[model samples]
Target: MASAALGEELKCSICLYFYADPVTMRCCGHNFCRVCIDHVLNTQDLESRVYSCPGCSIKFQERPALQKNVTLGNMVEKFLSTHRDGAVISCTYCVDSPVPAVRSCLLCEASLCDKHLRVHSKSPEHVLNDPSTSLEKRKCSVHKEFLKYYCTKDAICICMSCRLDGKHRGHRVEILAKASENKKKKLRNVLEKLVTKREKTEVRVRSVEERRRKSQEKASGEAERVTALFIDIRRRLDDLEKRILREISRQEEKLSLSSSDVIQRLEIKKEELSRKMRHIEELCNMADPLTVLQDPDTGDLCDPEVERGDEDIEENGVGDQDLGQISRISHSLADIIRGVALYVQDPADTLLDVNTAGNNLLISDDLKTATWTETCQNHRQTAKRFLNYHQVMSRRGYISGRHYWDVEMSKLGVCRVGMCYPSIDREGDKSVIGDNTKSWCLFGGQGYDNQCSVKHNNNQIRLPHQISSNRVRICLDYEAGQLSFYELCDPIRHLHTFTATFTEPLHAALWVCGGSIKILGRSSYEEP
Candidate 1:
């Protein structure tokens, strides 16, 4: 039961039966029995070689090649042939019972009665066939009327009367059989070219696919490297935070110890000074002033107390002076400690100046302000011509913008790509902007003359730490997914046109990143 259902599902929609010689339409992606589509089209007003599917209403610009589904068609044909004895089909003209056979005539648009069908068979001009062939024949306008003879002059099937007409006079024509044979030979030639074209297209598609795969792989690898770098930087930042906190704690502890020492010294000096001052006041207020007063002649009881009081007065004065000094020193130390605390607490105090001359330059001088006289002296004649050129910046990086300049070449063709050799000072290095270190190095050479030469040409003309610009060309090869630096032969080589295959496809926005060499025009690839 399952197998039977599967077979029914494969049947053509238009025929409402099992498929008979199926042909798939390229545009609509539908399959139908060949005879079914032919019959459907036969009923319509035919004009275009292309067709639209009846089921989906999809149009086909390129007519798909008709392929015969022999398995399905043979099965249907054999089934019908086997049941031929049991099936009943009456003659339309006679309205008679089951006629053993049914046939159609091409010349006459009518189904035949058995007696009348014999007349069609006997006529050499009339063509009789099954329904499918008969319908195809009716579609041929020229063969509508019974034409046993061929017009040799016009290469057409015609009645003997058309040949006798004066209209075909002096024309060289051949019978349709010979013309048909010539047409088949022409068709064979076209078929051979179509096969070749299809093979070429398939190869081109495969090549593009391979290049795309490689490009994706390279991008993935680059992303992974960048991710790892960010991870390392994050770890370092965490370590920096921990170190900063430890240093702050150490400074705080030192300030705490110094404050305690200063406070203890101030308290001790204050207490000692207070005790001596009391002793001096008590001695000065004594009842017997003469008795308290000290005498110089022979030590006696009358002057001993006076002498001790004078000694105490002197000690109190010295203590007061020492206390005053300690108070001043303590104040100075407190102020110093407070200033250090303020610096440690403020974030701005920790930041180094970012806008200094030695830092990365975020601003450039307004070159337009340079006087015309200065400009002419500073810029080379060739460089001045490209003064209008600008730079292109994208999320990825900066690229050299468009410019028009000429390089000595021998060809006259559409411009493809350009390479530039710009004068650069060896001191000017900007590669750190994109973490690309290789671009900063110049094509190094000896003394004044070598430096002068390199400054005039592109840096790609030499490797890092090299000493010559013997040959160099920076090429943008899209297919290779690479902006390659190459060495050119000396004496200024000619012959500009060239093509090469690449293992990968290129990324977009690459030309935007200014290279040591500038690309002048557009680039494209030929089909593989």
Candidate 2:
């Protein structure tokens, strides 16, 4: 009975089914599946600017704007998942007589019905997954066998034969089920972090949206408050021309000329916020465990696929938009909001390592801060450890797109803050940041004390002014080959910009020339 009511609420009035490619009309705030609305209004006649809602029949002379409702789409997906009447995972084993799958065995690589399961096997020796899954993916391609074990070294699944004598013979192997569970756990942590980020972003967007709404309301209130001004003007005009002018209409027309531009700009901003947060929210709500783990770029050494990216919204275009309106609205909105605006951003999740840290480097327990200690700690000798250089690479890395991070240092200390390639030498000349082709940094005046310098490929450009600040921020634009440095301040003062044609992935590099420095936690900055 409740489902039926939900079905009614979820359905589009035109097509009479739960919304698909759903869009909400601005006129009546009623949702209609995009196709249904298009068919109803006639796509050919969209330019006519005359349409009405099917539910409320509210007439709109301007063909009221449609906003894609991703949340509503997600709700529909969730509803369908529970119902399963529309799309069902049929038993793969039953070709001639297909039925809804009861159990999907990963070993046999097939979905089976209750009748098939009763006759197929005597005992359940295989792990099972949800019906809405392809069992064939669980088998090894080369061996044509069930992937029973996981090879940690190669980061691939292997069959029993491969585990015993094949390429993964000597590699550390764990049971497939156990390894999958571990991966799921890792995915859970990642999902939890992403959910927190999504929630925060949603809140920020909501705040800005509310602010925009209130701003529009306040503007409307201002028009309402100034009735006497319009009435006084109208009274004089009435006396001179003997014209009976509608005071409210006359005032709103003048006000709306400016307000329309502001409202349009705010709508565009709202859409941008929607576009940025939808992808994240979709990833966060993913139900497939394997898909969740595999979707994100984990910065694995062997195969460095930079798959996960939410850094920028390249999907939106500034083309064909009114430049004058944007410029005017920006100034107006800035004045209204007191110069505070939201920026699209991603927080760097870097953790310092005891093993990766040099013997002279002192790392904090939380791994957020690092310092140089005179006495070397008793640490194992590894190839990953730096020899002569006082440097550390961030655990998180960027293979593509833009990323920003800030480093806070002692006021009088010399330091290097930027990024380096993974192949940067751990020993010799190339080991030190800014001394080789693989590294780039904003050095604390290599030749002159207190002067700020930019370094890349063994070349240094010393700035004329001193960078007297405890906090320094670095912005990396990988594809564009622009590494920008800015002094962390109220206005974010630009210190220097380095241009380079980078060919590889980059990790956050911090080289303390002397004294101590700390990498601020995510809490310190605003993330969009």
CA-lDDT, candidates in order: 0.40, 0.69
TM-scores of the models, in the given order? 0.38, 0.36
Q: TM-score of model 1 relative to the true fold? A: 0.38
Q: What does candidate 1's lDDT look like per residue over 321-388, in tens digits? A: 23443444344333322211111111111111112111111112321011111122222333212222
Where does candidate 1 clash, by residue pair? Answer: 152-173, 153-173, 399-512, 399-514, 418-520
lDDT of 2 by residue, 289-385 (tens): 7775775533242343322221122222122334454354334332222211222323345676565677778888888777877787756888778
lDDT of 1 at 356: 16
For model 1, state the Cα shift of residue 413 in Å. Answer: 50
Indicate the worst ten consecutive residues by lDDT in candidate 2: 306-315
For model 2, what is the alpha-carbon lDDT of residue 241? 37
Give the lowest summed-lDDT range of ten residues in model 1: 344-353
